[model samples]
Target: MRQLFGFLLLFATAAPLSAAEIHDDIDADTGWQVITAQAGQTKIRVVPAAGFNVFSIEHAGRELLKTPPALADLPGVSYGVPLLYPSPNRVRNAQFTFDGKTYHFDANDGTNFIHGLVHNVPWTVRRTEVDAHQAVIEAELVFAPGTKHYAAFPLEHTLRVTVTVRPEGVSWKYEVDNTHGKSKVPFGFALHPWILYQGERKNTFLTIPATQWMEAENLLPTGKLVDLEGTPFDARAAKSLEGFVIDDVYSGMQSDHPTVADFRDEGIQLSLDASDDFTHLVVYTPENKNWFCVENQTCSTDAHNLYQQGLKAESHLLVAEPGETLSGTVNYRIRDARGHKFSRWEKAIRKFEAQDRQHPPAAGGTLFVGSSSIRFWDLPKYFPDRPVVNHGFGGSQMIDSLYFADRIVLPYQPRTIVVYAGDNDIAGGQSPETVAKDFQRFARKIHAALPETKIVYIAIKPSLRRWNLYEQMAKANDLIAAFAETDERITYADIATPMLNEQGTPKPELFIKDGLHLSPAGYELWTSVIEPLLPRAN
Candidate 1:
């Protein structure tokens, strides 16, 4: 019955649960078991059945991290934990040439050589033991030479990862033994832990001790280290991970030592420690997402290629001799530092907000505002013929639109302001009336502040996934159009009408696989709709 339910869920979510549904025991005597234990002020346990993982820290029975459904299914499993050959974050064309030969690997998320081949592969469970105070589990994963999945790199390797849990914290140790006899194997490795937390990730505090940072031209490291001075990349202290966009790799760390990252707020305090072998850390903070990643890596993106380029030092490469093994560890601990974090987070938010508020949006160029979908849009390409200033944020509602109107929309003094919003507000469960009112408020704010500026409200797009809210969205559009009618300066651009299919629903071809967001075709449609309304190129 459990297997049936798991299989059903896999199809429903479109996310495979092969790793998550590994039960505690295989029938009566064939599988692994889930173990639980408590230590000190923290409670810890392991899933010996699935990768021998450890998880669920508690102080007085309260969860330290947000236990979402996806997380609960894989109780103690860590996602994207790298082994053997750590993949690069971004690769040119998702393929790299090594030793004058081209190698192709799986592109997990559109463009990057993610977590390597070992990710999602099952590891054989070896042993499991649990006491009232602690639980320890161990596992061994062997990759045979010339295996089809890993045929790109023909090297036999035996990888062993051990996980230990206690009330103090949970620790993971990885050991990779090169079984390919007598020949040096060039490979990369990294650990990507899917961290979850409650409330806003922007409220969290993070610190990485490094003397210098690496600069990237196109996701590939330039092998250069600039001093960490007056840049957002500086993580020398416990700074709030808010309002800063980062997807770069940092090098020249104090040591090839495990660095500590802490998040303290809302009655919870959590800390993560990476191993000494983990030299580089990639900090990924997407706009408005509830979670952020502080990935510990042994080398930078495309390390193998970088190695060939002689861009990376010989010391940075981990060349395991015949029968030799490479090893490392990572630890996560939870504690209570709510008061400190609350005050710190509040101050941080105020400081960042003030910085944003101080810089009011100028009214001279094209002003783009609203949600991440807009922010993430390549403005240069999207408005190739016009000068555009991007002001879109992720997960922002109409209220945020009004709030940041001055900083974002008003600053450009744009001859024409192109507004692309309301999608997130609707998705956030806001009523159409409420969204309409917010739009009205936004219009009023813009008009009052810069009466000469022309306001062009792009109609809310029809998304296939959010078709249930199509009627409400149309109603909101109607209200906005009605409001536009009252002002000569306000113009409504009817994009939704053209974007709809014959059935009067959102055209599926316009949406990406996610159904809610636009694909390249959708963007092209938007570009066509907006091109005419924009002022003639100066």
Candidate 2:
């Protein structure tokens, strides 16, 4: 039997030419880097030497951020969204006592250490890529026990940061891991973003969702918390920064809550949503400078001194103990007053929510998710004795799992989960390596919250229609299989194997009429292979 074909590549505006791109370059003198990411009318540029922070964000040939003139000469932390590692703000006398040892930092901010060591240092660009949606760059910097980074901070740690620039917005993620094998390290972080607007202070409005402001002496918190009420610093709601000097550190954001600091000026709204890992917000509107800073912080200024003074109530510090890693995210989403193509998937996502509400699946089942193969699975016939929930959507990619994982998979709370994707991704021309990394990211997001749960990834299978991509699919499966070996919670089910015959060709009888989706016979083949990989139903 033969089936008709419908390829979306003909009429859809999603041309391969419109995809985003990232270019890596190096400076001649400083040996620094200039990484540029471009997508449609939206463009982003960064200097990895400058803490890998975004140096420019342009939309329709207009710069959205006001870049300082001395960007190349001045300290990076003073401009752009600087990666303030180790600590966010100023530390008194460039010194702090951690675990009964007084460590001294490089005194660049007069007598205090303004930003951590990586702001002016170099970082290695591990990976950079541009897909249909966004351009991403992953960079890392490490400090050894005898290096200057350890000389100042006295802790051996590594920081991996990733920056993503899409048409909708830009986001930055931080992962700080303790590398000393059995030791512990304490650290704090803040991303200092000085956003620029076109209008005057009175015309630009700023709002920060914070409840309390910490009173500080000489830029260090004095262990006193004052209510953010009745003062010029009360930016709980949108207010203009007119006629008042501004420099403040505020806390009291709810955990896991996204605290949005909205800045509207020149008919454009730049929304900075800091995750709960960031407990403090610093707003600096200097009377002399035209730009304003909306900083997301993880702790108070001079947190070590506050901790030494027994002010545990006001200080929030992060620790990297053995077998433990810490991560935080800051999403800077943008909304243009003019029309833009930002919410193309809103309808589909909304419909998904509506469907979930209308018919919710039972919790604590073996969850099957991803592309049409999983969607078209005859779960009852395959796994009749086990409890199973299938939430597979249309011909989806790896990112779709990340998009709807919280809504669908998280609610089920399955004892064991299985994902099948990357087929469409490879068919759409994404590299095998990129597909593997995307699957890794998806699994990490799940296990971050559900540590005890086991996750299984079904290797992208070969079908008759898309057999041209079988090699790439096999490579993707190989990479993911290797990654699964590194994580104890993940299991890689090599289902792509038996689907191929002895001649290394796809089994045509396994495919449906379209020669793409799986047939009942194909589902049977999967059942025979994947059942033994799953845990026995309790």
The number of the candidate with the highest lDDT is 2
lDDT of 2 by residue, 54-121 (tens): 86776533455656564465346666677887877888889888778888877877888887777877
Instruction: Tell me how candidate 1 scores on lDDT.
Output: 0.61
- Number of the top TM-score candidate: 2
Candidate 1, after superposition: displacement of residue 405 in Å?
Answer: 48
For model 2, what is the alpha-carbon lDDT of residue 72? 61
Model 1: residues with Cα > 4 Å off, grouped in runs:
1-85, 97-102, 109-112, 130-133, 145-148, 254-258, 338-538
| Per-residue lDDT over 388-499 for candidate 1, one digit per residue giving the tens place of the 0 to 100 score | 7666666666666664453344444567777878887677676677777768767776766467878888888888887888788888899999999999888898989999
lDDT of 1 at 349: 27
User: In angstroms, how far off is 519's CA in candidate 1?
Assistant: 72
Clashes of 2: 0
